[model samples]
Target: MTRQPFPRLKASAAALLLFGMGALAPGAQAKEAAPLRPQVAAPLSSFDAEVNTFLAAYWRMFPDAAVAAGRYAEAARLPAPTEALRKQQLAFAEQWLQRLAGLNKNTGLSAAQAGDLLLLDNHLQALRWSLTELRSDRWDPTEYNVADPFAQLLNKPDFAPLPQRLKLMDQRLRQVPAYYQAALAKLSEPSPLHLKLAIEQNSGALSLFRDDIPRAIKQAGLKPAEAAAITAHNAKALSALEEFIAGLQKIEKAQAGAGRSFRLGKALFEQKFAYEIQASVDAQTLYQRALAEKEALLQRMSAYADQLWPQCLAGEAVPADRSDKIARVIAKLSERHVAPERFVEDIKAQIPALEKWVVEHDLLTLDPSRPLVVRETPTYMRGVAGASISAPGLMDPKGVTYYNVDPLDKYTPEQAESFLREYNHWVLQVLNIHEAIPGHYVQLLYSNKSPSKVKALFGNGAMVEGWAVYAERMMMESGWGAVDGKPSAEMGLMYAKWNLRVVSNAILDYSVHVLGMSEAEAMNLLQREAFQSHTEATEKWHRAQVSSTQLSSYFAGFSEILALREALKAKQGSDFKLKAFHEEFLSHGSAPVRMVQKLMLGQ
Candidate 1:
């Protein structure tokens, strides 16, 4: 999943909140131009007006976020991450906190509206905390990338006609130099890890100017002068990135072994978890739960290993050690994986099958009209995770949803073998269930359709990642791995191992950030305990350093969602329907699972 630092506040919602009850507030109407629809709904209107005003300012303040969230008209603007910008953002957040305080004084909010108020409060608070406390902007050069937004425009060409889109791309391209130059000036002693990531990503991103834009220019059939202008802009953009990379390299050389640590430490990790994950429990408590979960998953996997060993290794004797026996069986199964070349091809093929199964089981309604395009992970986005879903903006709901799978063509034979084995045959299907069909793609589609724009736009990470994780368990429990209605032990074993990844992620992140887990310790934890391949463990270690509190989302979200489902089930007894619960839970958009539970239970 992509980690956008700023919240993508809603445009229409802000316009409604700003002018829905009366004329636009001073200096707002000219910027928004949204029609005023005054509501006579008393206190609701009062609260709604406040939300709208906040949204408008938010949209203006973070146009980049707005564009990403589907305000395509704002695509030309690229806000630099400078000190002045951060200060302004800090003040904006503080001012909103006070405004929300005033809104909290009013009474009689519907549960959904009240949830919106909380979302706003948490969003502003998180923004404040990030700027004032976390302060990654000062130390993470990766935070200063221009590649992603550029890729978004070039990849989603249907957003406008060729000429119009090219015009916007040109407009944004001209500003790229200034963007990176400003970033270089502002970056303090940066993280060595993030600097490496920035260099790799920015270098790969040069393909846009070299290959993508030239093709686009030719196809658009621009005049010679217009083409020359774009070509010149591309050169400047390329030079800017090259210069930034050189600057980062110089810093890396000078600050070797002396750069700021990637670890968030205990205090920062807990606060970030509270703000980003928005889980009911603290980070420490969740880490403890994950430990218990790890032990339980091991017991289950060991049982499956015993059952499978006798069948697969009929003549061989089992190892006396429990860990050794399980490892042997998993290794045998891992050898059955596909060739490296078929990695992405295989993923695309399984998507339809996953959708078919979901529909066949009456699990949830699947939208056929919305397109899902499975593509190789773009070079600029490959370092973090192996697979992810990039959904269309709210403005472009009908646009394509990209399922990005990192191809293994670049991996050496050893790396490729280990990577493929990690995501072996059965687990790959489970992965498709998580990253694509009935996972990020489906959940995000539902999020776009949600009535609460606040929940939709300001999505909680735990809730989003959790729903995907929950979908995996939900799919399996609904007999997805059954053959003629009998559960396959192989599928069961693979799933248990896969679920270990979710458990291990929380443990790895918490241990690294808070407990100062060394690479050796983390590797031992993953390879020995979680049964992960060396390749997977290595990438995960890299991910942990670059990102904090994100890994914990899987377990935290899965646990909370399961609790919420059971509570609703017990409340309604026989009346509870799986599809109804799924739709109802998703209908609130992507609010924190806790707030969603309160809304679902009508608290």
Candidate 2:
């Protein structure tokens, strides 16, 4: 370690040579055409028209996000896309994907070009899956109402003017009755678990909408007439939404006896697994990997404890009555440096410092275009972000990256300890690594600059998340921890904890859907096996049940990334620049690391 002098953060140029070889190759000259300068600009027209459309539609999906992320202006600009427009947009994507049919994956792409192709493929798969799910599975407005279209609009600041955003909400709400009706009429078979969990999550989240709409209107300071009209509009819309939920709840009982009765047939399940994850590995293979990783991480956890805290004993098999113990252990281990009231404030302070450190230390060459902000998850949808990043849109080369935090503000006073104990300072910093700087947001930001649509579209969960987890591990291994300078070992241990948790998330998904485990049984396993609080465990369990393919992404992606990083190190040998490798790695957006390795290793 001493002789290497490890250059705390320098990037590997070999990666650029490998991934962007065409640009770096003798006389290749083009991709490395020196970024946009004050006096000179890159020719925009040279980018494919379909690529431009890809960027535009990407922003259109979250118009509010585009505004908040500062990609586009709010006034007199493009309307937030309606559902119909979304379909048209998807159709365009389909056409764009087809237009590139015979093109070779490696024809002329810089690494970024290859990444974009991956995005094109994955996004095509995901978008198509979404459409199919809507037509066949439940398309209830409740989840969309709670999750993105409306919730994200309200959550991101300056997304749209109140009236316009309200109009968007009103439209979404107004359509609820019909969408619910459509869902009931068109759903070929009841997804007992999907319906059950989706409805519950929606109903739980609705309370926030109930609380926030008025505040939103009040903050806008519209005239009395404007307020009244908006109120009238929303009242009708809200009434319909309530009725829709009522119907969904009624439907819940309509299929009361069929709890967890749904099974995605082998073909559909296989298709979805492949499409959502971009992994050809079957569910069983994934399950096996998850099982192996879980045990492996458990063993690693034991080893770390043995080395660092020799007195502590972590069991090899399932422990009895250990939630309280784990919680206590995390708190005792974590409280040394965490200042809860000032968590966000501290994180904000660290961003520039980390940015300066990375640059000065010769970390990867990063895009100056992407700017990141650490913001508290709006009181409205913190539950969803729960320490996640709202990724940059493809259209906005320079996008505002949000590091969303779901503070446990609503928890009962008595439950405060449990609510936040999981978020001890070390874990929170590691989480920030996962969501913000050098993690998901960073990965996606560089990906946005990539030229290949398939890379972005077909983002493998394993790749995106694995890189993030790897980022955390990488930083810790290099003796960087606690944005405020603390022992990296604790952060490393906590990273291991979440690594275990990610594996647990995948296993629980397997248990619920494939092994036919009951919700109660699943909940117990989460608390016992994964060490999640009962409440947190229940919330995640619900998420896994409906967000089927998504649950596995965290662990699977992380594992793939780790393997890829090692392979890259081996391949590049003395030429491996950590910073360059990481920067070049992220430049392609999020794809299976195998694909990324091929693209970057000059395969």
Candidate 3:
């Protein structure tokens, strides 16, 4: 098996959004754009050279990753860069930004060519903001000698050999001091709340350090020298770390978990809202729209339930009871749909069918770069029900994409049965389309080799989420959806009903945490609006109280993607190809759905 090289470059979320808008490029405005069409695209970009250079420079910077990235046995022996070298790299970021800013993006080109430039511009813009403005020298507070990824980086068996990857950890660990100092040097006045949250966020990490370090050392099979070195460094870092922790704790105690919420002051709020929508849309206004939409969807879903689930009866349809039915059906279908069992098996079984399906379908342009393996979520992260597709992180030229289903076995057997029955084969199949094939993976795989180095690292969340949700609707229209090709119109309403629920998902986090809505209040809104199960509502309530900006990423992303698709259809006119358009939409790179929308439309 060949190794997938490490992703050397750092990308902000904006760069990623541009790449995600590859074909669309965000500016082509059209009406009634093709929906339910499979999005297979012609392969158009490569990041091999850029990725190789970035990885090489990055490995030079964080040698500990060599082991995790399959480049070395241990970073223990690697020479740690002196403070001089650290300064040199920071300078390099500045020079790179300058160099990037000088590129001539507007050399007469095709519509696609212009879109690529937009991605390029956005990428450089984010790099300038992060490297120069934000100046986040190290990833953040703690440095680990061992590569335990709690972020975008992950474990891919083929990325690098384990021993080689391990070799870089020591070097990375040694740089912790340097990174912390860099963060301090670059630290600007706190954004009032983010600073506080950043501090409070460390609390969990302190416990993690106290518990996770020794285990990591053992798991990594440390030599006495390596072990001793880690222990000594841990001790020294811990002293300073504890001081930092104490300071943070003091601030946090004063705020009482309030500062960490999502109350973006008008200035920050507008910036966030703009980046989120990927078009000219306001966050607060969009949220109000969501609230209204949520009400309508609840009514529609309830009505659909009464008709489809006749047992809901003529008298007194208890929403709690009815909601249980909705959850139960979704849950049951979901239960039977194991990542290892139903999903993977279906992918394999459909190889023959898909071959024919693609050829016969007449809308998609399947690329050979696609090599999929469906699997159950890894043992570590199974708690989140529902599945997700992770596009290749540091493996393969085209990162390996996984259609990960949350295994039902973790639930009680009875729960499992209900889960399976509720989720149903149709819902599971639709979810597959949403996560894999012509959805997230398809979009992300195209995004993997974006020309903009800036975007590869910092792709935004809205585009990622919007495309997947949009695909749900698109797939339903195409015959390649649901277990049964022809689901009843009620199920169609079910899909739309769920689509409207995202509005609540979008703002609930802000409402509860930032708006100071209590869980009881939040739960009531969610229950009344989303028709969510108590369990689901409660889960979201917890998620809302702690998380601030992320829940908004989804709906905002979807709207921007849809907007771009419409624009592209209008610009491309009668000649537009859904397959080609989708492929192109994600090819440019990821950026905020709005920032890249102009590019998506080739404006």
Candidate 1 residue-wise lDDT, 1-603, digit = tens = 332222211111111111001111122213221111122334656667777788788878876667667777666777666667777888887888897877655555666676677677767766666677777776777766676666777767677777787788888888888778878887788889988988888888889878888788888888999988987888888888889889989988999857889998998777777767767778898999999999999999999999999877888999988888889899988888988888888888888899999999898999999989889888887788888887776667767888888888878999999999998988998898998778888988898899877778777778888999999999999998787899999899999999998999999999999999999999999998888999999999999988887799889989999999999999999999999999999988887787777678865
Off by over 4 Å in 3: 1-101, 104-160, 173-266, 295-303, 309-363, 366-387, 393-395, 403-429, 449-458, 480-485, 509-516, 564-576, 591-602
Model 3's lDDT to the true fold? 0.48
Candidate 2 ranges beyond 4 A from true positions: 1-47, 52-122, 125-136, 139-143, 146-232, 257-267, 307-361, 365-372, 376-385, 397-399, 451-458, 482-492, 518-536
lDDT of 3 by residue, 325-351 (tens): 554333322333444345446654644
> Candidate 1: how many backbone clashes?
3
How many residue pairs clash in all the candidates, one count each? Answer: 3, 32, 98
Candidate achieving the largest TM-score: 1
Badly placed stretches (over 4 Å) of model 1 are 1-46
User: Candidate 3, 204: how far from true, in Å?
Assistant: 10
> What Cα-based lDDT does every candidate model obtain?
0.78, 0.54, 0.48
State the displacement of the C-alpha of residue 424, model 3, in Å, after optimal TM-score superposition: 6.1
| Model 1 TM-score, 2 decimals | 0.92
lDDT (Cα, tens digit) per residue for candidate 2, span 1-603: 000000100011100000111011112123222221122222434446556665566555434434333343421133322355446645754775675443323244444454454445444544555454423333322233323445545654555576667666655554445544544453334566656544655565555456667677778777888777766655665665566567667767876745434544455454555554544356678889888877777666655554444334344333343444444454457445544566567767777655655566566565666677777665434333356666544544444677766555656653555545566666666666666666766677776666554455334556766677787777666666654656645666677787777788778766666777787888777776666665667677666655555566666667777777788889889998888778778866555665666666665
Would you estimate the TM-scores of all the predictions?
A: 0.92, 0.71, 0.64
Please give me the total number of clashing residue pairs in predicted model 3: 98
